[model samples]
Target: MGHRARSRTRRNCPSLQEQLVHTTFLEELVFWTVKFEFPQKMVCLLLIMLPDTDYKEALTQAFVLHYSRISMMLERSTDPDTLSNRVVHVSVQLFSNESLAFRMAENLNLLHVMVISLKYMMGKILIQNTLHDADKNFHYVVDCGRQVMKEHCYWPLVSDLNNVLSHRPVAVKFMSDDNLLEMWFTFLAMFQGMNVNQREMTQHVEYEPNTYYAAFSAELEASAYPMWALVSHLIDSSSIDLTKRVLTSCLIALQDWLDAINFTHPHMNDSMQVSFHLPLHRYFSVFMCQAIKHQGLSLQEILPPRDVLTLIMMHPLRVQCFHWFPTFILTITITIISSHLISSHRDMERMSGVTWATISLTPLGISDEFMQPGQRMRD
Candidate 1:
């Protein structure tokens, strides 16, 4: 009787590989499982019971599976857009579980794989956008351009990454320790073509916001939104040291962007010039205001916003930008100046500096009331 019971117990247990495969399968079941409360609870229970090593294995395999699909799609051998999208869709679902997010990001190898994939996809996008076809109809071409920007693999992936980090403080801390923040900053700077010295005259535009030039610029701005969103998450951290570091890196990135713009703007036509109204530029003031209020940290402790503003204004590109991007620069300049003023306000100690600055800047003078509690930015 004892021997028979032992044999049955052994048969009931799954092997390690089976467990890993089951973990991966759960990602696929998210949609169906989420529709019914009991199934979702069961899936969550299984996730909780899974060992760390098996979860990591599942994650690695998931990345490999999606990357392979993406490669095939790019090759035009087979269009597996659905398969590729599962990568992001599954990731977002997985990140909805904080424990899973922690496990996903805690592995340094996983972080590298994720970031490298992001960079690869973005590089492909930049290459595709740089080579425009002039033969296509203007409206049709603009629509196509916008579609590519929206449909590209990088778009959803970066958006998911931003969303994940926004809520997952543990994951953010892990990523920051791995220098993911700096990597993102550097990538954004290059993605803007700030590092490329050569500039070519683009096909000219007849009017603003209606031409291919406008579409192209809008695509650039849209692509940059995630990076600034990540910055917002970082500055919102509780650690003064981390906030200080983020502010400094923010300044460095802006200076690099300014220098590159100054160098390239002169050679480009009005239609092709990079706009200063990108998310990174617009959000810098908010970041500064948040940092100033972080744990009562001083402006001097964080990099001075005035210094960044001075750099932007003093750059030779500024005069040309004022001519071409007046509304863009003026809007951001006012926000930054307002933030600078709010930082010095004695009431800042009593009220949230970010709320104060935001209310003052808004047209109707309404303020965002929700202030998330801060978390440690790093280990």
Candidate 2:
């Protein structure tokens, strides 16, 4: 009776289907082994869950998955633009574990694959950021209602990628079909990260109390966009496309900010920070210097026409910017002083110093109350 029961159990079990699927998977693995000539250890590590497997497989699997993912994402991103959040999660998960991420970054092949994936995801997120809700009629979900951007779009992926590059600078992947697309995508991604926005990022805010945060985002982008320092070290380009794009985006964003801040119809509330646009000329100086010193491109090629610069300088926005700085500081001095980084080869050091300076000056930037009578902030 026990033997009959055992026989019945064996017959009823779904081993036949499971074996067929398993066998097919193994056969495909063998085909990959033969076609790609992938290392046995690497293939085994990727295809199976083994005890104490080497991380190289994780890196390999990430690249393999990324290639397929990119193809899928590109196809779906047409017309209707179906950029799945799943791709974002999958891309980030590859680097979720700290140990594997660093290790994966160490390998050039893995790092290249990782960067390409991030470039797409970053660009995708940015499109949503720029065009949201009924504003542009996009199908993708807004990152979050409160923030101008979602954390996943910038943090850890872009931030950690920058970190990894700082430790070990890698080559640009050149994976995009054209160089212009490559530059624009990378620049936009890196731009999103130039300013660190939130606290702990993982925790969501119910709503940003001040709507200025949104305007401030564009304002901050305009201010910082001039220090397009990453362009020289990161891209392999002689084209004016990147420089043109940078100047154009910065100017347009600057205009948007100017319009937002200057217009009285909207009316700012009392809760808004008082000295938000103070020292705006300092960023304007940094942009000119950094662009001229890009090393890869000529000043004439990268910068707007002299007449254009003169026009911008004379604009109502630029004239109003002078009121923010000390009386001793003039518009020409703001544009003439230039960035120290323009002369030095150490882009990283310059950025670090600038970041530190920004941090140190934050408290000074805050105001408990407006100046008494005509007291100047530079005092």
Best by TM-score: 1
Candidate 2: residue 284 Cα off by (Å): 9.8
Residue 192 error for model 1, in Å?
Answer: 2.8
**For model 2, the run of ten residues with the poorest summed lDDT:** 264-273
Superposition TM-score, candidate 2 onto the true structure: 0.35
Candidate 1 lDDT over 176-255, as tens digits, reads 55255555555554333221111232333333332334334443544445435555555444555555555566566766
Across 96-187, the per-residue lDDT of candidate 2 in tens digits comes to: 45455555544423444434444444344342322111253222221222222422223323433443333313322221213323333334
Question: Candidate 1: where is the Cα deviation over 4 Å?
Answer: 1-85, 125-150, 191-237, 261-279, 293-295, 303-308, 314-332, 339-379
Assess the local accuracy of residue 165 in candidate 1 as a C-alpha lDDT between 0 and 100. Answer: 58
Model 1 worst lDDT window (10 residues): 370-379
Query: Global lDDT for candidate 1?
Result: 0.42
Query: What is the clash count of model 2?
Result: 0
Clashes of each: 0, 0
- RMSD each, Å: 15.4, 17.1
